[model samples]
Target: MSFLCLHFTRNIHIHAFYLKFSRILSTQNAYLNRFVVSLRPLNN
Candidate 1:
C-alpha cells in the first residue's frame, strides 16, 4: 500500500511539473515574438 501511494504521489509531481513547464514555454514564446517584432522598424 505504501508503495502504491509513493507511485501515485510521484505521478502527481510529474504532472504538475509538466503543467508549469508548458506555461513557462508559452510565456517565453510570446516574449520572443514581441522581441522579433521590435527588431524591425515598421515605417511605411
Candidate 2:
C-alpha cells in the first residue's frame, strides 16, 4: 500500500515537471517563430 502511494506521488511530480518544461518550450517556440517571421521580410 505504501509503495503504491509513493508511486502515485512520483508520477504526479514527474507529470507536473513535464508540464512545466513543455510550457517553457512552447513559449520559446512562439518567440522563435515570431523572430523567424520578422526575419523573413529581410531575406526577401
lDDT of each: 0.94, 1.00
What tens-digit string does per-residue lDDT give for candidate 1 at 1-44? 99999999999999999999999999999999998788767733
Off by over 4 Å in 2: none
TM-score of each: 0.78, 0.96
For every candidate, C-alpha RMSD to the true structure in Å: 2.4, 0.4
lDDT (Cα, 0-100) at 2 in candidate 1? 100
Report the lDDT tens digits of candidate 2 across residue range 1-44.
Answer: 99999999999999999999999999999999999999999999
Enumerate clash totals for all models, in the order shown: 0, 0
* TM match of model 1 to true structure: 0.78
Model 1: which ten-residue window has the lowest total lDDT? 35-44
